[model samples]
Target chain A: MSYLELSNVKKSFGTTIAVDDFNLSIAQGEFVSFLGPSGCGKTTTLRMVAGFELPTSGQISLQDKNLTYLPPNKRNVGMVFQSYALFPNMTVADNIGYGLKVTGKPKKETNARIKEMLGLIHMEEQHNKFPSQLSGGQQQRVALARALAIRPQVLLLDEPLSALDAKIRLELRLEIRRIQQQLGITTIYVTHDQEEALSLSDRIVVMSKGKMEQVGTPAQIYTSPETEFVANFVGQINLLPVKVVSPTQGKVKVGEQILQAGKFGHLNGNPIRLAVRPEELNHGFIEGANNLSGKVEAISYLGSIVRIRLDVEGNPISMDVFNERKLTIPSVGDDYQVTFPVEACWII
Target chain B: MKTKRINFWAFFWVVLAFLYFFLPMYGTLDFSLRMKKGVLSLLAYQKVLADPQFLASFRYSAIMGVITVIFSILLFVPTVYWIHLKMRQLRPLVEIITILPFIIPVIVYVFGLIRTFSGPPFQLTLTPFKTDILMVAGYIVLAMPYMFRAIDVGMQTIDVRTLTEAAQSLGANWAQILFNVIFPNLRTAILSGALISFALVIGELILGDFLARPALGPYMVEVGRDMAYQPAALAIMSYALTWICLGLITLFSRSNNNQRQILGR
Candidate 1:
């Protein structure tokens, strides 16, 4: 059964529609992420769940109670903003205790909760310090602690790690996941960072413009995207325009070369794109693997993985090669042969 | 060489400004001390301080200052917050209205206030208590510009919409958001406005004189009409009060080294 549900929710600002016919049902204790680029209606969806923005149409219910037009304060949904939004005037403990205090929680209980939250964020020593006294990462941690201190029914985090340094972002991201798992709180995280969304969420909802492109688990979203937008947005994938030669046989024409897409099954478009992850293509051909020849356009040594850009029959494709001590570095002008199993490519 | 020329010009202006500001104050201090003739003494200050009427008027003005500060803050802080958060399009209109007090001269403004509220359908100046009410209203209007701008500038310093949303999502009502979040964050700004309003109320004269209230401004003017040394002494005291207010603004507005470290610089 679903715990928090947004049913046909739509939001419009004046004439522009921000979120249209959005529907999602998140199960209890699930961590779901809304992943999209800027202005993709992901934050709008999260805000609706938190009761920060009232949906123009449709209902949002938590555990079967309709909260469609409820005021934010009446809804016990906790939200962490992108900017931390820590109360500068309050100490870390006081900030975390603010929600509890508002709900008339007893002093002893509120203090206990504050201590628990501070411990959760590993900032017990900085309890009395104000937000301005802490670093960006520490401030965001306090903000998260503040949100969770209320023991809200559901927690909403809106790009909370976007403002931190890259290293701090990674560390805090892991810390957030650990805390979420420990508490088993239902969480909805919004971020434009696809890697963050993929690693941190149980299910990722890829959004574009004002609609959901695809909703699936990390592996499913990366390997078998339902739409071209999802394939392009979630991860780096080379999309080659091809013509379907035989629908039942999963045969497609990639330039003058014919390739097999694993489950083409009833595809409609004449010149649909064949999608393949860069890492799926091997440097050399194996038996029963489809092979393509291209000239190396560019080789970028990116520490752990070397991304080699290649030109195949007027189309550009990239392949990621894992860096090993015995691996050969292909020059820019060298001809490269890449192969991928039939199952590795999909028609989007 | 370029810096030397710039420094010379800066020094020249500073000297000029110092003389222009302090010369009259120095003369008043000198005159206020020579009350006993030839021998410098604090006789003027002593007489001014001993007068019962002076004490009563000073107390009244101080009380009025406190009331005006409180009401101005209660009125303008929310007005500015609403303007910043929801009705931002009304800001230019609100800004014009707040500055109307400055545009209209104090005598003209007091006359308008008295004419509107004295004998009409709402005769607010009928009793002494009612007249004091009129005086406070006048003071609030007179101090509106400073109060609104202080809170507005403070509102600009922080992200008001995001903070309100954060508080609201955390189960805070509108009142809680204002008292616990907005007001505390705007402490320096509100303090600056309140002090300026208090200072303005303390030295206000036209409204008190016209409304027939026993405020310090009218009392000082009355003393100036009849007494020489005492008025000079009062002037010096008022000058010192204004300086103290300005000094407090400077001190509090230094970003509260311990409390206010803004994120992202």
Candidate 2:
């Protein structure tokens, strides 16, 4: 049985729909991420689960109990916000102890819990410092501690690292993963940053325009996106328009060349799109691999990898190559041939 | 050379402004010490401070000020918090309402209060106790503009919705969120507003005079009418009280700012 479930939840504000028919079943101790662009209802969906928002229809249940209409305080859920919403006047220990204090926990137990949380966040020495005295990273850690001190049924984080510097964000992301793993807490994180969602989540639910586009493991979401929207949103991809040659055989025609996709629907002789990750396409042809020739349009040298943009028969495509010491960099306007296995490209 | 010239002009203007503000206060202080003719003494202050009527009126006004501040905080803080969190669109209308106390003259406001409550379905002015009740309501109304503005500004500085959600998700109901989370965060703002409200109550004359209450404002006017040196002492004392309130505001706000600077928000 699922530990936490959101069944066909839909939320609409006035005439505009913010979330529609969102369904998910998360197991205990699993970390799930809602990944999408801004205004995609990812945060709204998370808010609904946290009881900050009410669904227009459907139910949210935890451990087989209906929690849809419960107020946030009664729901026993804990949430960390993007702004690290720590109580400014409280010391770190006091802030972490706030939930326990409000829940009327005995003073002895609350102090022990706060001490454990401070240790969990690795801030034992700084417990007396106020939120204002802490750095952004420290404050967020304190917020995480505060949320977890309640030993909540579920934990929700709404873009918690979006406000930090890049280095702190990376460090805090690792810290969050470590803490969540240690506690074995059921967690849901919402963010527009694909890297954060992809790296930190056990399973990701990619959403667009208030609808879930796909839900799968991180590798499945990245490698086998079921829709064009998911393919375009998750990572760097080259989408080439093609015409179907055979529906059952998964054969398609790109320009004059025939190519085989991983799958194709029952749309014979219909136009389709082949989506391939930029990193999957290799430079130069190899045996038993599909090849495509294109004119190099631009090349950008990122620190670890170089990305090359190409124009293949009026279609713009991108390919990523690892930067090695002896590797030769291609120039603009050069004719280049890239190869990929048949399984790399999937029809969306 | 150009910067030096600008600094000189700035210094000149500052000196002129200081003279404009302090010259009258200096004259009052100087005159207040002249009650013992040909020698400087604190006889005027001693006389004013010794009067039983002065002490009673001062005590009444102080109590009234404290009561007004408490009521204002109880009423305005939650109203402003609701306006910030849920009814944000009601903010403009609430702002206009808060300022009604400022736009309508206090005399007219007190007159309206007397007419409505002094002899109506609820005669709040039937006794001294009831009259004090009515007077407190008037003071809260008079102090609403500053109290609301200070708190609204404080609310703007923090994200109310996110903070409320965070607190609620941690098992805090509405009361806990307000008292524990929101109130502590707004301490500086509330203190500044409370001090301003207190100062306004201490010096308020129109309400006390019209209501026939023994407030410090009316007592000061009576002393000014009959005595020569005691009025200067009272004026100086009132000025000092206001300055102390302002000074406390500066002290509290500075500490709040120093803490905020550590967060860089």
Candidate 3:
């Protein structure tokens, strides 16, 4: 049995469904992220798991125990809010010790746990200071420590790093993942930033408009998205509208170029979209399985990589190539031929 | 050039407003501080401070101020929180009701209170406890507009729903969430509203006089009618009391503003 299981979970607010038929089985010690844009129900799913929100119709079980009717306080779940939600009046130590104090633990044990929690977040020196005295990053750390202080069975983080600056957000994301792994706690992180989800989650659950779009390892979700939304949302992809000429051998015609996408089970002489990642397209003409001649409409140099926008067969396509010392970069208005591996393109 | 002209006119109007507002206060202070012969003397202050009636009124007013603050907090803070949390849909209606007391003239309410509680069916005016209860009811109504707005502003500063959920997830019950999480977060708002309510209770005149209670307002009216110099002294004392309350509010709000800046909100 999975450690934490959500079966057909659905949530609705009046006429609007916030989460619909969401199902996932999270294994023990697995760090999973619900990744999507705003209004995608990622936060709602996290809240349902944390018992802050009740599922409209479905079952949520932790270790084979049904927990649908239980209130949040009895759920033994911890959550870090997007706003940090640190108790403003309490000192760091008091905030960390809050859970222990609430559960009627002994004073000595609560004190020891608080000290240990402060050390865990590297905020020991800030124990005496109020949350309002801490910086944004420090406040977030304190919020994390406070949530984890009680050793909850499940840790739910609702975009905890979204409030910080870019540099601080990156630093804290790694720190949070490290802490979750160190404790081997089952964690559910919710975020809209694709890079953060990719780098941090063991698996990513991409959601859209109150429905689960796809669930897979970060690599799988990025490389082979099942839906057009996922492919477009997970990363920048050049979606070329195509008409399938043949079904069995996987042949499609885009503008003037006839392309073979290997054997795709779904496309059968119907108009479908093919998604190609920018990194998969090459800059120069090479005799390959899949090749297209196009004009370089625009070229942007972004320090480490050069982004080239091409007008291929009257359709716009983008390609990202590494900035190397020996290679000649493509200039705008230059006619160039680009080639990519057949397996890299997927029909959606 | 147009912008500069607009700015100049704005500054001119602001100065005019300041003079219009403060000139009466300046006249009142000058009149209260001067002696009967028109020379500035401490005599009015000394006479006001020494009178037994004036001392009783001050003491009663101070007690009522503290009582009103405690009562207003007890009644309004949780009501506002509940409205924000569960009855969010009813917010506009509740807000209208809270401010209704302020809109209705105090004289009308005072008359209603006296008639409703005087004898026969209610008979509340015959007993001191009943009369005190009536006074508290009046004070609550009088203070609701300011108190509700203060608490509402506080609620708007933070995501109360998210904070409550966070607290709940951490094993805190409703009581813990209210006293520890929600109330502490609302400290600045509560203090500000409490200060305003205290000042209002100390300075209020209509309800207490109509109810025939020994509250500060009636006591002040009695002294003002009988003693001329003592009333001026009492006015000065009241001004000092109001200044102190307002000063404390300013100090608290400044610190709260600093904290908001630190949070970068």
Candidate 4:
């Protein structure tokens, strides 16, 4: 059995459902990310798991113990907020020692634990400073230290790096993953940043409008999205509307070309979407492969790579290629042919 | 040149507004300080401070102001935080109720409070604690509008919902979250509103005068009938008290801003 299991969990405020029939199982020591845009119920799910929010219906079990009805204080879960939520009135040491104090731990042990936590976060020197005296990154580290000092069964992070600048966010993302791994704590990280989710999570759960769209490994989620929403949301994808030409063989007709997408059961003479990543499309047309003829609409120079936008049969398709030393920049309105292997096309 | 012209006009308006507000206060201070004969004696201050009734009234008002601030915070903070956490949809209704005191004139409410408390159904007015209770109740109603607004703004600024959730996830219960998390963060707002409420209770005349309460405002009115310079002195004292409260608020806000700046760095 999974260490943490949420089955058919639902939550609603008035008439609006904030989290809908959400079901997930997190194995012990697994780091999962709830990845989606703002208001997509990622934070809500994390709150439910942390016992900050009660599920409107269904059950949440941690380590085979029912946790849905338990209050946050009794749940033994720790969460770091997006804003850091460091207690401004308390010094770093006091903040880190809060959970231990609340649980009635001995002063000597709590002090030792607080000292160890401060050292763990590399903030031992600043333990006497209040949260209002710390920088944003430092405050975030303190929050992390405080949450971890509790020795929780599960750790929850609600976009913990969202408040930092890009450089610090990147640095903390790796730090958080390293700590999660080192401690072997089951963690659920909620974030809207796709790259952060991809880089940090053992598995990514993509949500939309309070519903889980898809859940898979990073590579699986990026390469083979179950729906057009996941494909479009997880990364930049060129979604071209196509007509299914056959059912037995994955054949689809796009504009004036018939493309074979290999054997796939879902495509059968029905209206479908053909999704392809930009990196999969090459600059020159290849024989015996899915090919499209189009005019080069625009070319963006991005240092090491060139992004080419093509207007193929009235549909815009983008392709990215490494910048060659001796290559003519494709001008707007210039005719060009683009090709992609059959396996790159995903029918959604 | 255009920017300079805008700056000039802005500065002129600011100075004009300050003069318009402070000129009368300056006149009151000058009048209170001047001697009627030829010498500059401290006669006005002496007369105002020497009266037994004046001293009693001042103590009464200060005590009431402290009680009002305490009661207002006790009643409003938890209610507002609860509304923010649970019944957010009822915020507008709660806000309306908080400002009801401001909408109804004090004279009207005082009349209602006295009539209701003096009758057989509730003969609270006959008791010794009646005056204290009535005064505190009136002040609570009077202070709610400002106190609630200040707290609401503070709550909004910190995104109270998010903060409460964050605190909860850290294993804090309601009491711990309120005293340790929310209240500490709301210190500046609570202080500012408490100061305003304190000043308001100290200077309020209509309710105290109508209720026949032996408070500073009623004491000032009683002295106004017998002596002119004493009343002027009392007014100056009240103004000074308000100014001190405002100064404390300014100091508190400045320190909070500095702390935020240091944290931002």
Candidate 5:
């Protein structure tokens, strides 16, 4: 059995379903992130695993033990909230040692654990200071250390970096990744930010509404999204409605252009949708590749890369080009041909 | 010239407010001092302090204040915390119910309490002790608005739900979440509320007068009608007591604010 497994978990409040038939198994010492927009049941699923919320239906087990009926305190799962929910009355050391003290660990051992946590979070100087005396980043570190102090069976983080500045968010994101790797604790992270999920988790579960859209590794999820929602939600994808003319040859018709794709998993003459990422498009034509001409509708000058929105036979396409010293940016109203490799086009 | 004018106006309001509140206190202090003879004396204070009736009434009122504070904390802390957690939909209703004391007149409420609790169904007003219990109940109801607001605001300042979850995740049961987590964090807010509740109970006269209790409020009124100097002394003492409560509130909040500033929002 996996370290933590959730089977067909469903949650409903009145008529609104918060989570529906969500199933996932996390291996021991694995870091999995439940990634989606707000109200996508990602947080709800994490809470269920933490035993804060009971699954309205389905089973949850941690290390072959049934945890579905267990309360949060009994489940031995540590959670860090989006808001650093450190006890304001307790000093930094006390906040970190709270779990040990509450679990009736000896005072001496609790003190030693608190010292270790302080060293782990690199906040030994802040042990005597209260949570209210620490900065946002510092408080979150203390909060992180507090969660990790208990040495829980699973560490659940609910958007722990969402309540920070962009720079601090990035810095803490790397710090959390480092800590998770060092601890090798089975961690379930919930986040709305795709970049944070992509840059962190060993595997990402993309959710929408109340259903799991896709669950895969970061590379698999980004490269080959199973659902259109997952493809669009994970990253930028240029979706084109195409008519599949030949499923055997992987040929599809995009308006007036006939393009050969490598993923035409459909019947002949069926209207299917194809997704191509902006980064996959190469400027100028290449031999034996799908070359389509379009008029540049707009050009966005991002640092180090330029994004060009092109109108391809009335179909809008977004293309990204890295700024090469030898290459010039395509302007609006300029005619350009972009090459998309057959393998790069994903049929959704 | 502008700085001079600003300081002048500042000093003007300072003097005006000092006299506005201080004049009555000064007159009462002077009258209390003139009890023995031409010389200023502590004779009235000594008399009031020594009297058994004064001692009993003051002790009764102090006990009532403590009971009211305890009752307020026990009743509202969990009530407000629960409303914030599971029954958030009923928060507005709870808030409106708390403010009903402010809407109803105190005299009418006291009479209503007497009518409800004095009959055969309860007959709580028959015994002096029963009436004392009624007094504490009445005080809790009267102080509900302030108490609930204090606790609700405290709950708002922290992520109460998340904090509760964190505590639970750390192996804390419900009782630990209450005493160790929620209650400790809300210490200052609860203290502020208890102080307000204490001041209200000690200073309240309407309930004491009608409920036929031997509390400090009725004792002061009895002293006021019979004596010339002792009433002023009692008045000054009560004023000082209220001032002490207010001073404690300011001190607690200032310290809380100082720590919060270092933590930052």
Candidate 6:
């Protein structure tokens, strides 16, 4: 059974619709991520679930209780903001114990919880320090501790790691995941970073322009993107136009090449976007592989992966080939041949 | 060559400004000290400090300053917060209203206040307490610009909406959000605003003069006509009081030092 559900949720500000007809059901203790670019409705959906934004028309329920128009105070939801909204006036301990104190928790319980949270975040020595005295990552951890002190039913994190340095962001991301897993709390993380979403989420909801484009597991989202937008937004993808020549045998025509591809299961004899990842294509053809020949236009050496942009009959195709000890790097303006299996081509 | 020219200009202004501000103060101190014709004496300071009128007027203005500060806080803090959090479209209108005191001259505004409340159905000036209330209202209007700007800037520095939401989500009601969360965070801002209002109310001459109130401003002017050294003494005392206010603000901000402090090292 779903622990939290948003049904037909819609939010509009003046004439601008921020979230339109959003529908989803999250199981208990599930780690779900709303992944989208700026101006998408992912943050809005998270805000709605947290009772920060009242949906124009929808039903949001936790278990059996309806929380459609509940104010944030009665929602029992905890949130960590991007700016780490820790109370500057309070010390780290006071900030973490704030929720407990306000909710009339006993002093002994609040003190014990604050101690536990400090130990969890590994900042016990810095309990008396102010937020301005700590680093940005430390401040955000205190913010998370404060949110979790209330023992909320749902945890909402809105781009919580976006404000940190790259190294600290990675470390804190792992820490947050560890904490969430240990607590077994239902969490909704919102971010535009695809790698962050893909690595951290049990299920990912890709959104665009106030609408959900696709919702699936990370592996499914990466390998079998249902729409063109999800395929492009999630990772680097090469989209080439192709025409279905035979519907029965899953045959497609790609620029003077007849390739046996996956079944479209839809319309035939119409041009569609054929999606393929850069790493899917190799530098040489093995047995029973479809091949493409092109002139390399640009070469970017990215330490582990050598990205070569190839111009194949006026269409640019980006291919990432791993750099092994024995393999020679490709140069620009060189004619190269790369191939992928027929099943790797995804028609969207 | 460019460095020399910039240094010359900067040095010129520093010296020019020093003379412009320091000369009159130096002259006043010299005249006030020469009470025994040739020798420097503390007779003027002694006379001013012992006078009954000085003590009454000073105490009255001090009380008036406190009243104005309270009135401004009660009036502007919620108004500014409401306009910021919910009534966002009214922000521009509210800003213009806050700056209205700065746009209209103080003497002109006092005249309007007198004309509006002097006669007819509401003759506030006839009763002493009513006229004192009117004086407090005038002081609030004059202090609106500084107080509102201070508070609005404070709200902007922190994410007011996000903080409010965070507090509300933590089971805090509106009163808790205001008192426990926002009011504590806005201590420096409130202190700064209160100090500025206090300074303005105690030093103001036009309102007290026109309203026929025995505040410090008119008492100073009244003393200037009969006494020479005593007026200079009062000037020095007022200058010291302003410094004391500035000193308090610096002390408070240093304690609340998330931002860089400006005074009282």
The best candidate in terms of DockQ: 1
Residue pairs that clash (backbone atoms under 3 angstroms), model 3:
none
Model 1 earns a TM-score of 0.97
Candidate 4 TM-score versus the reference: 0.89
In model 5, how large is the Cα lDDT of residue A46?
90
List runs of model 6 lying over 4 Å from the truth.
B118-123, B259-265
Ten contiguous residues with the weakest lDDT in model 2 chain A: A262-271
User: What C-alpha lDDT do the candidate models reach, one value each?
Assistant: 0.91, 0.92, 0.86, 0.86, 0.89, 0.88
Error of 1 at B160 (Å): 2.2
Badly placed stretches (over 4 Å) of model 3 are: A283-288, B1-43, B119-121, B255-265
DockQ, per model, reads 0.67, 0.57, 0.48, 0.38, 0.55, 0.42
Candidate 4 regions exceeding 4 Å error are A239-246, A251-258, A271-275, A283-295, A311-316, A324-342, B1-27, B30-36, B209-211, B260-265
**Candidate 2 lDDT over residue span A119-215, tens digit each:** 9999999999888878889999999999999999899999999889999999999999999999999999999999999999999999999999999
lDDT (Cα, tens digit) per residue for candidate 4, span A19-66: 998989999999999999999999889888888778889999999999
Please provide, for model 5 over B1-265, each residue's C-alpha lDDT reduced to its tens digit, 9 standing for 90 to 100. Answer: 9999999999999999999999989999999999988899999999999999999988999999999999889999999999999999999999999999999999999999999999988999989989988999999999999999999998888778888999999999999899998887787789889998898898899999998888899899999999999999999999999889989988887777634422224
User: Candidates 1 and 6: which is better by DockQ?
Assistant: 1
Second chain TM-score for model 5: 0.91
Q: Pick the candidate with the highest lDDT.
A: 2
Candidate 2 per-residue C-alpha lDDT over B5-54 given as tens digits, one digit per residue, 9 for 90 to 100: 99999999999999999999999999999999899999999999999999
List pairs with backbone clashes in candidate 4.
none
Compared with the true structure, what per-residue lDDT tens digits does model 5 show for residues A95-117?
A: 99999999999999999999998
TM-score of chain B of each: 0.96, 0.96, 0.91, 0.92, 0.91, 0.92
- Please tell me how candidate 6 rates in CAPRI terms: acceptable
Please write out the lDDT profile of model 3 over residues B111-185, one tens digit for every residue. Answer: 887887776888878888888777887888889999999999999887788778878988999999999888877
Q: Model 5 shows how many backbone clashes? A: 1
Tell me the docking grade of candidate 1: medium
